[model samples]
Target: MSVRLGRIGYLNVLPIYHPLETGILPMDCEVTSGPPAELNKLMDADKLDVSSCSSVEYARHADKYYLIPDIAIGSRGPVQSVLLLSRRPVEELDGRTILVSAQTHTSAALLRVLQAKLWNIKTVFTTGSATDVLGTGERPQAILCIGDEALNLRYHPDYPHRIDLGEAWRELTGLPFIFGVWIASRESWRQNREKVEEAARLLLAGKNWGTDNIGDVCVMASEESCLNYDEMCSYFDGLVYDLGPEEQEGMRAFYKSLVETGIIDEAPELVFLP
Candidate 1:
């Protein structure tokens, strides 16, 4: 049986998916593209055999999936994209309303964790279109935007206070923050182990190719997004794709914080396919 792979349609993930899109990896499979939340829903419905989904998804449903080792979308420092845009200072927005982008899950959870553990602020969160919130002239005191949208609005002077969630996580925990991970359903892996293995190999190969050709990837991504060439290059430069020992430790730390914040029931063990 052929595998169905879910790819995140975000500029931040371009490095990993560019090779696959350009036929550099040469794999036989059906590919679906969507945001993190949409991919999470597809995986939950078993519509995707393998997908790069929000890291929080695995922690929430560890029994149903096995993480594909050695591949992820993360950062050690400021990820130029994921930002919390605030009209007022972050500390000053304690009792105010915050608008959240519906495109992400991990970032949302990270924001909650930051509020509870670091900021110690109680604020109300409401979900809506990031574009509408930013452009409608009716902006909330704080707004959470991720991916390309966040990258575009981060430098705007209207929102004076911009908080990078990745940077905040690094400062709070001193570890690289993992936003997304490639995962395969446990049932899919058990039934078509060879196919899943082959897909995983193609993904890793694609990521490696993209990393070596960063300049080309940045040029292509810049053409597609509003970010200029230099900004795109700088953005991709800050992103980390390796799921090394340190990233795993950071993932666990994030899961622990999520549990402590009551965002998730428990921090699941990291299980990988052989």
Candidate 2:
């Protein structure tokens, strides 16, 4: 059987996936697309062999997967997609309730760490569909949004104050925030080593190709997103596709913070697929 791969159905990953989909980078695999949270669940349920999943997923289940080397969906600054839209300045939000999107794990944990360590504020976080709050006429002081929804809702009329989580992490620790990483199920890998390696190679090569031909990618992504071509280009510029030394250090820092804030029991060692 071919490797079962999951793709994040978000524009932020367009630069990594566009090449493979268009046959610019040949790949032999079965692919499924969905939100980060959904993909994370599939990975946990052993329904996917490989996926670009929430970094938090691997951290929470470190023993279950192996990280694909030199690739991630992360940013050094201003990740337009994981955002906290607020009715007031973030600093003034102590004790205020923040509605968190059900479609996130990494971003949610990042927000909690920031609230505890950097913002030094005590806020209540409620998890639910953002639509639920809107439907109930409950005006949460802020709401967290991730992926395409966050990008599109960054300019919500009711929430004028925006805090980009990636930028916030940079300010707090001077490091890039890794939202997601390419991971392979260990059980699948132990049985289909060659297939897993091939999948990783295609992803890495596809990432390179996509970034190099970003203009074409932007055009394609624009059709499926609320943003224009120029906006798409600007968004891609802020994203990081490589998990280099600094990014690794940043990821470690994030994990450490998560541990400190009790979001994680301990820092999970990053087990890269060799």
Candidate 3:
């Protein structure tokens, strides 16, 4: 059987799928690159067998998705790529307007969790990229920017106020934030468990190589992101490439928040391999 493994085309995600670059996926399986949001839809539509998807996507389609453990895009603290940039102080954010990135469900859900549990106030939540959103409002109170945009926003001198959502989640939950996970459609996996396991094993091997050569990964990432090597490495440091106990807790907590807010009807538990 043929498998189309969809993935993100970003430096941070490169290491996890480095095996693809090195031709490590089984010959019958093909790897393609796209944002997590797109991959999630593809998986839901049953157009792909396995893909790295946003945890929120799994929650959205609980019946079809199953998590692939020991591999993920997660963060312990201060993940530079997922941030909430505020025009004002975070504590004074009540009844203020905020723009959220339309590309990521995970980032959008995190904003709801923060508003519900910490801020104790909710206002208008709109959708757009950081630039488009910032341009739309007279002055947006805050804007949620994820991926490379968040990293770029950190360097801007004017937007001095910002909060790293990953760090904030850790502070709130004492657990690492799971940003992304590999998931397979249940129907696809039921027919091809052995192939899926083989692909996962290759991914594990690639992750090991990435951890061992972080310096080179950082260098390559710098070029792709246009950040200095050191800046890129610092962003990379906060990254936890595997899903462990802490990340699972964080992921579950996030899903619980969605359930509480009525964003999703129920929490999706992680589906693991024996």
lDDT of 2 by residue, 61-140 (tens): 99999999999999999989989999999999998889999889899999989998888898888898776676787778
Candidate 2, run of 10 with poorest lDDT: 130-139
Query: Clashing residue pairs in candidate 2, if any?
Result: none
Estimate, for each residue in 114-150, the C-alpha lDDT of model 1 and write its tens digit.
9988899988989988887667787678889998788
Task: List where candidate 2 sits over 4 angstroms from the true fold.
Answer: 135-138
Top model number, TM-score? 1
Alpha carbon lDDT at 127, candidate 2:
90
TM-score of each: 0.97, 0.96, 0.91
lDDT, candidates in the order shown: 0.90, 0.91, 0.78
lDDT of 2: 0.91
- The candidate 1 region of ten consecutive residues with least summed lDDT is 132-141
RMSD of each: 1.0, 1.4, 2.2
lDDT score of residue 153 within candidate 1: 84
Residue lDDT tens for model 3, 152-262: 776555567888888888888888888888877777778888887776676777788788888888887787676899988887888998888878888888888888888
